[model samples]
Target: MIRKSFYMLWGTQTVSNIADIVYTLSLVTLVFTQSGSLLTTIFIPLFRMLSKMISGLVAPLIMSRLRLTSILMGSQLGQFVIFTGLIFYLWLSPEVSYPIIFLAVFGMSFLDGWTDPARNALIPRLAEDEGLMKANGLMSVSDQVVKCSGWALSGVIVAVIGAIPTMWIASVSYFLAMFFTAFIRDPYAAAGVQAADKVSSAASGAGDVARKPSYGEQLSEGWKILATNRRIRTLAIVDNIDTLGGAAWLGAFILAFVVEVLHQDASWWGFMNTVFFIGSIAGGVFIVARVKKLQKNAYLWMLFSLLAYVIITFFFAFNNVPMLALILFAVSGLPVQIAGIIRRTLIQQNLTPAETPSAMSALSVLSNFTFAIAMLLLSWIADRYGMRDMYVVAGVMTTAAVVIGFVYRSAFREESSPAYASEENVAVNKA
Candidate 1:
């Protein structure tokens, strides 16, 4: 039963991810063709990032009051409705307005913020501790598969069927995602309802003295937990630092490297991306096959993964041969994929089910903010210095951060928590 539920959730998420890629590609193509304005085309990503930031900030409060299943299903339904409306509007008017496009993107991205955290939190509830690593590895594999296939296919689909028709198809994907999400069994739903009933009973008995937490207080709780917990705090800092350096892999920097250093055209850029995704898929498969062995020393695996990424990236920066560069790029993807799987599994293992939602949301907020700032700073540095120089800097900084993380490895030592233990026992019994 547990395995069945997990597969259902995974399938739903896979469909949704593919839809997202197609939708974004179609929208970008439409905007650039109609407006012929680079600024308008760029604003799409900016709007998405901003909307995600806002939604991440508020997700904890919403999750606290609602079932994860409801949040997941509602988010998918919301996207379906938005895309359906947009398709109808285009069918009627057929004029692509920048403001309207931005608004649509904002709505879709805002809802996406809730979907990710909710899904991450739900995984622990559905899988036992012994199986958590395998589950996470499977998720990573699915994500990489979707990214490679969706990105590669979206361009062709848009060109052949047109962006408007592609949007309609994406809406159907969302509808299917919503339909599948409805079947997921959230074990926490009963407990949450009971807790809410107890709260209401206490409130009535106490005659107005028992007040629910305000939105501001609820919002701050996630951040407070992250700040006060030594293990969580240390992990958050390390991950953010890593993300700061990893932002150098953005398209602008990659394009610069290809054009300036490799003396290659846009086709090489696409090929390099394909190679990286293929490498990521290979890494995911390797981790999934070794999930049991890796779970015993997840932190050590994380450290090794980081070291491997740093070494490969350093070499990649200096290599000029196009074929060698392609191989290096493909090899560089493995460590990051392994590191991501271990990190996510470790986080889920450390936090209690009740705390997982807020903790993941806080982490999401930090990641998005740090990535945005890093992209801006790195883009400026790349503009002044060469892209190769920026890659070297990124590799060095990431290595330094990983070394610092190892120095504080004691913080990651697992401590017995009754909440987590109880949740684990429940999951094991269910399995």
Candidate 2:
């Protein structure tokens, strides 16, 4: 039953992610074609990121009161409505305004911020501890596969059918995703009902009313958990630091590197992204095949993965050869993918079902907010110092994050021991 639920959710998410990529591609092409302004084109991503930041700030409070399934379904429904509206507007109107496009993009992204964390939280509930690594690996593989396919197809789709038709296709994808997600059964729903009953009984017997937590209090709980919990706090810090420099991979920067540094045409930019996704897919396959072994040495693998990415990225910054840069970029994806899988698996393992939603929400907030700021900062640095210099700085920041990980390695170290599983189970049951 759990496996079935997971697969269903996974399938829906994959479709949704692919649709999102296509939608983004279509919107960007439409904006650029109409406006003929690079600044206007860039605002698409900025608005998306800003929406994520806003949604992340409020998702914890929303999740505190809503069922995870409800949040997932509602978010998808919201996207469906927005995309459907855009499709009609584009079809009828001679020209769509930039502000209207931005508004629609922001709406979709805002819902996405809630949906992403909710999906992350839902995974642990649908998979056993022993299968957590495998589940995450499968998710990573599916994600990369969708990304590769979506990106490859988006340009073709927009070219062949035009951006307006592509938006209609994306809308249909969201509609299907919403239909599928509606079928997911929340495993904790029964437990939640019983818990609520118990609280009510206790209140009645004591002749006292139990007050629901205020929205501010609910929001604070997520922060408190991150601030007080060593493992979560450490992971969040490391991830945020990594993201600070990770913006070097943004499409514009990568295109600059390919064209200016490698002296290559635009096709190579697509090729570069393809190889990275291929590397990530390979890494996912490796994890799925060696889940037990990787879980036993999860932290060690995580540290090695971070170091490998740093080394490869640093080397990648200097290489003028296109082939070598491609190889380096491909190689760099492996450790980063592995590190991400291990980090997510460990975080899920440590948190109880009750705590997962808020923790993941907080983490998403931190990650999205930091990445948005970093992109703005890094874009300036890239303009001033060159894309190669920007890549070098990213590598340096990633190395610094790895150093911090090593210094606080004990938090991750617990995952490697047998007793950690038992302790984690006890914590979950207590919650």
Candidate 3:
């Protein structure tokens, strides 16, 4: 069985995920309703992403000073307080400025940015090494569940009761998430985490005192670690490129593909989305059930999964039959799900427990930044060149990642040594 703390973490994440969807939908509806400006509604997500990128850039500093559980709880509490105030203002105000709502969205997302890195860091503390894949699989499944069910449910709740009441429900969800976060324990304390810093400082001498690192050092710590570690550096590059390529699957791009390529109506777009999500959930289940066999060859599993993406994506790029397109899309999620769960497990396994937050934070920054670029760049490609060219460009990017993965295949060996301190790992971590 997974530990109680993992369950607690899962519960906290699940509620927060639900709250996020509900809150975003309500905010978007309210902004468009009140302002009647599409640009105003667009700014809500733009501001949220910008704030998260900023938060991610500074996350290492906050993480360096606090325990993972403390960071998680504090972030959740901060978001809850800000969101509650925003909801109250929305309820009372006859006329609210766009900036007011954007500010609240920014504040909440900034707090939320710290949650993922902290949570990923904490999972290693809660789960045993052997069960790490299972733990990650469970987390992935919950995320997919929230995406599938939470969106549908929140949509209905908002349409029926209106945005204000929906915000109230989201507020309650955030409060519950904060309550659950309070109960999560980090079994591993600072001993492992702080040792690296202390060791580096100890070289100062017996009589001399070592100066503490500045906040700037703390902020860059993750980047330093990422640069020093060869396997992780390679993985980071691949993951970011993959994210850029994956932007083709975004809702806007998919809707366009459905309408222009498949020659289907809007209802087929929804059908394709539902099928894709269902496939993801099914894939997560398949992984959980067979994690033991899969974990052993995780590197190969990841490679094969990306290969599946290459095949499915190329087929998806040219295929005109909506029914065939649906089948390929559904099948596509299986490999994607497997790759994601294993990749996360591998990263956690490679990093020292204490190093995880910084690495995850650094990675989160790259991911969010790449996604933003990919969204705009690929959308333009789709509109200017054609959907076919857009998907082909995406496939080419994924193919580049695959080539990198193959060239560095030895670095991903399951039996390879865990990531050593930079000097040792750079020379020795290769399988």
* Model 3 segments more than 4 A misplaced: 200-207, 418-431
Name the better of 1 and 2 by TM-score.
1
lDDT of each: 0.82, 0.83, 0.83
The top-ranked prediction according to TM-score is: 3
**Clash pairs (backbone) in predicted model 2:** none
Per-residue lDDT over 1-431 for candidate 3, one digit per residue giving the tens place of the 0 to 100 score: 35688889999999999999999998898889888989879998899899999999999888877888888888888888999999888888888878888899999999999999998887766776456778888888889989988878888888899999999988899899988988897876666555656644764656577656677777787888678776778788778888889999998899999989888899898888888888888878878898879867777888789889889999999999999999998998888898888777777767776678888999999899999999999989988999999999999999898889888876765345432223334336533
- Candidate order, lDDT descending: 3, 2, 1
Query: What are the per-residue Cα lDDT tens digits for candidate 1 across 1-431?
Result: 14577888998999999889989999899889888989879998899999999999999889988899899999999999988888888778856666776898899899998988999988878777557777887888999999988987889999999999999879999999998998899876776555545545565675555567678866876787577666667677778888888998877788889999999998999988888988998888888789768877778889889899999888888988999999998998888899888877777776766667888899999899999999988888788888888888898878877997798787655553321334443233221
**Per-residue alpha-carbon lDDT of candidate 2 for residues 212-331, written as tens digits (9 for 90 to 100):** 656786677677768876777777888899999887887778899999999999999988999999999999998989887887778778878989998898899999999999998888
Question: What is the TM-score of candidate 1?
Answer: 0.92
Q: After superposition, how far is residue 85 of candidate 2 from its true place, in Å?
A: 1.7
Models 1 onward score TM values of 0.92, 0.92, 0.95
Candidate 2 stretches with Cα past 4 Å from truth are 192-209, 414-431
TM-score of 2: 0.92
Please report the TM-score between candidate 3 and the true structure.
0.95
Better of 1 and 3 by TM-score: 3
Cα deviation of 145, candidate 1, in Å: 0.7
Residue 372 in candidate 3, Cα distance off native in Å:
1.2
